[model samples]
Target: MTKIGKKATLLAASALCLTGTNAVAEDAQTQAELDALRARVEALETNRAGPANGDFRIGNTTLDVYGYVKADFFYDFEFDQGDTAFVNVIGEPSAATDGTFGATIRQSRIGLRTSTPSGIGEIGGQLELDLFASNGTAELRLRHANITIGDRWLIGQYWTNFQPLDTYPTSVEFNGPVGIAFARVPQVRYTANLGSNTVFSTSIEENVSGSNSDDPVLTAAAEYNNGTYIARASALYGNAQTIDGATEVDQWGVTLSGSIRPWAGGLFQVNYIHGQALGPYLIGLGDAIVGGEANDVDGYTVEFRQDLSDKWNVGIAYGREDYDLATSTGTLAFTELETIHVNAFYKATDNLTLSAEYIYGERNDVNSGQDFDGNRIQVAAQLNF
Candidate 1:
């Protein structure tokens, strides 16, 4: 056997008996032996678990494979909202139903991560994909592909810097709430960590909104996290063009978000956003630009979570977005959208989970002078690897 292997075997044999008559010496020796045994067990798990536990090494680099296969079954009680509880569809009249049942595995995703030592620092990258393509087909969609230089620089496609990912609410649904800002874009980002509690990041990202924008968007954010508490602020600015490419408009946005854990197993999170011509970044809530001008919009999300037991946790989240659009004599558009989600997650096994959620969504049509709402019940089963 290899020298290291023999040493491990010998250590295991010597530490098999951890008790002795002498109190102090026995305590010290037993503690040392336990530490050695723990390290050996960790090494064994790292090597034996392979990709299952996302630990392994190849050559000079470490590679981790992680993701889960999630299948969701949902029943919509007012409108057929399909896989996602799209609140925008709630106010629409067509396809209205008393009940509609659907099942989808499109939320399932897989990722490969690599880290290696370099001259400057540790270089790492991630390539992740999911089966939730916009076309409704179960095609592979790129989630993130990024490379990190040291700890401060990131280059590639990833979450936009304007997104306060640290304080974002969690839900069983893919896109949790309506008022939250959500988008992934290609960008080059620079991050600065001040002391140990504060961080700042800035990026220039591609515009992927419905309103075409040839110019890149500039985004910046700052955050402070101290164990159980977090606070963040983010902003973005850019220029957009009409679909016909005839009109040009200015785009800008800002968001403030934070989270706090008061009790041992309880957490509260909230965020507020106000912006113009930023519908694309706000979960397609309202028009980014209309008639040569950017529409004004604001949104907020409030959430609370508590762990009931070691294997179960529950949460409730509420989100709402409002739009300020020109009210014409006969024009029609959405003025407000809101959603509420209450969910419970149960850990069935080390690698398996079960979850259920109830969602209520509402849409207010200003010009049409109508209000519509819908309810959804969803249950999901996920297997992690």
Candidate 2:
């Protein structure tokens, strides 16, 4: 056997020997043997678990790793940046059937979760990572790590209370709706069960903006479920922003979301969020458009979903985001950017799923910020194990 393999076998034999002698060995021998056996077991466990690869059980918490893979096709229409509203545009554009297609890994993340023993309070947590093409590289899209204490207290990074669970739709592209919480920063939270399918949660977390400041974020939410329907409302406040010469003002937002299962296999979902800026950079500017004033930014989104059958589903999503530019050279706030996405999915079997989607987006300030309109049609198959 290899050297490492032989060592492992020897350690296992020693552990067996010590355990076997404990029944008749003296007290000193028993204690010494037990210590050696525990040390050997721990060493082996560490080697087996490896780094970043974990399947560990500590106390009542168990941990595992999991993730998903995805690919897509994309295209762009009205892909121009210069003046185009009055006559012939300054740039050439292409449509969906013009052979514009590409693939993306999107996100392939791994995470862990654990549950409390039966009849006791429960706790769990997870983390995910993804690849972003905009910066020509992979990035840490979802860095979440959290823990629960006695079902009432939680500490870690998770989804903000302001975002609802139903906001995440099943899509092939891996992109989510705007004005939604894809993930949250580290936080301390409290949860109370109000009985009969009702839960109330409040949290204090660092602002998601990776900036250098003392401002913190606060969130509070309540959720209710009554057989066929689930509804949630939440509020958030924070003074966080960009660090590279960009000053974001204090901000507050509100979200309301709900889901309903009207029939045996049909589902309905709705979500809304509104935010206001609270600093000099955000004063006097329209909330839906940019360049009107300082710190002016606001956005909203809506989505509808239908499950036609066990293997097919369709959805439409729309979102609008407006920002106030720091200078007049920047594009108009309202016409800065807008996006719409439509998608569908079909499951071929228990393990294979196929999806197709179309994405349309427009940017008002193409010269200053590379704003343009584009379209994408994507189809991919995924296997689950």
Candidate 3:
């Protein structure tokens, strides 16, 4: 290609990267338009990070509306876990039908984000909601409602600071594979950038598990990212008390997680967490305390993803959790949990994706004396904007 042609291609890529948008290719585009777009991209690139790049602008603030319309269809081969693949519920067979089919649009969500420049730096806010509030019904549930100041301070509800949010496994199921820390809570957090690729942060977060306690959770995290690889370490501690003020214990956890790009279109993600009185962070829905003592819990997840082509990709993930109960007064105490997902995705367009996945899960009860398993297959279509 000629020098002019090569420059045009680079100009287009810069435009897309700056705006975070996918633009349709045009056959009759002129050189003058490309030159103008390149100028805009260059200006934005020269500015500091976290600049508002949304298509809509009101005064100094830029607004972006995002989210996806997702529909999922699944069939349980052994036991039903509802629209969500909550495999931990698998239990001894009963009159409940084994082979059941279900579908839902509850995973669909919408969010609005806005950012404006300030003398201190930049101010931003986000409000996000989804339709998964009620079981078996689509009700709007709040996902994120937060404000950020100067890209360093965050206040309000968001993903818990301790979760490895970036390294979560990719799956067609809304719930994904479990055995990982996952929670959303209100908090005030401050972050310090060590350089272009490293950051340290701390927060005092609301203790959702401490209904009877008067203190907030303290969390700290450090992360390093250089485009091709990522690593993070996080720790949290707080006082938790059981309802009726029967028992109060120290609730704490530590997490190590990372993602690596091993080859072109190939990625690997792994995470490990160990804690006591984990609360809702453990998606297994287990109690933070059992029999007047904090439960010791450990969980991990690993996944690999490979791209077959520009339009197709596949991923496989395994997750597990083990519990050490200080006291077990019944035979139904859960001792272990495991789950797996094998999934494939095809992008029909820049904004639409179709996917299919197979899910398998197991739970061990009463000191691993009894085991239950569940199998299911799922397919989904998602349209993002």
Candidate 4:
């Protein structure tokens, strides 16, 4: 209990406390180094699996290669005209399979894209092609050769950035369009990103009219998109020629589209397009109005899809188009045509899928009126790298 004894005890206690604090500090430094080492290893592993480089680079140079090859076997039943035309065009065994079955490549495509940073902005190019023909001849499908001066300018032949993704429903047999897309053209586009989730874009491409060397088709669009929902409005205008010997200029229309996911993996989508087909702009029209050939096409589509899981998927879609024909005596209006399709898919594996689809269509034109009730059950195997 002496004063000297108390001072000695306090000094010993202070030295022990200092030693403990130094040990804790050393442990903290070691933990920080471990964390940094783990992060670096993860970055290297990710880069090894993906592109040689990571998602981005300091100079803003990036590249991606993506594509899939698919083949399927299908059999059509309920021999009808509406459906027969679609199947026969794709080299199907006519309305009657004739007890013979065959397989075809369903749009096996490959694409490459790369972008490099420029002083002003970024310049990029993309090329997509299909190589399924018997001779192994590849055909160019998507080609976007252009520069994006900031986010405001893009000159290329890529998507117009118009219609919503839902416009292209899930079809096992990918013949594409099937008279669904009123206008899908090539053009020079200007896109402005208002925010992270909002964008406005417009394009001008070669028109059917306005002289053999006139400006391209004109299109403008605005869209707001989040992870779950996308809403868009777009317009298309161009010169079109008439069915007869006359030519009228300046034909255009507007479109609205949106998509929503209601459940874990379910989606509902709809698109409305109303436009005029004047002069040359109606070149893509498929309605035969007898005496009325130059007619405006207007239509809409509704599509829905549900993915039960990675193995199962189902979808349904309906589309209708009305053509207002230009007749000699007067205007002849007809229902034109309508189509409904349902499809289901079962994934046999990550590289294989089995699909079945049913499509029904009706046309007001007698020749087109042949009830097209077609059913296709196909098994397809795909490889992706």
Candidate 3's displacement at residue 74, Å, is 0.5
Off by over 4 Å in 3: 1-52, 92-96, 209-214, 326-331
RMSD of 1: 11.4
Show the colliding residue pairs in model 4. 83-372, 205-216, 205-217, 206-216, 240-278, 240-279, 240-280, 240-281, 241-279, 241-280
How high is the lDDT of residue 211 in model 1? 52
lDDT of each: 0.84, 0.57, 0.83, 0.56
Q: TM-score, each model?
A: 0.85, 0.67, 0.83, 0.68
TM-score of 4: 0.68
For model 4, the superposed segments whose C-alpha errors exceed 4 Å read: 1-62, 78-102, 131-150, 175-184, 208-215, 242-246, 278-284, 287-294, 326-335, 347-354, 366-375
Candidate with more favorable, higher lDDT: 1 or 3: 1
In angstroms, give how far residue 187 of model 4 lies from its true place.
1.7
Residue-by-residue lDDT tens digits, candidate 2, 86-135: 10121233221334335555545445565545554655565555554345
Which model is ahead, 1 or 2, in terms of lDDT?
1
Q: Of models 1 and 2, which has the larger TM-score?
A: 1
Report the C-alpha lDDT of model 1 over 296-338, residue by residue, as the tens digit: 8989999999999999999999999887873222233677888
lDDT of 2 at 117: 52
Q: Which window of ten consecutive residues has the lowest lDDT sum in model 2?
A: 81-90
Tell me the lDDT of model 3 at 235: 99
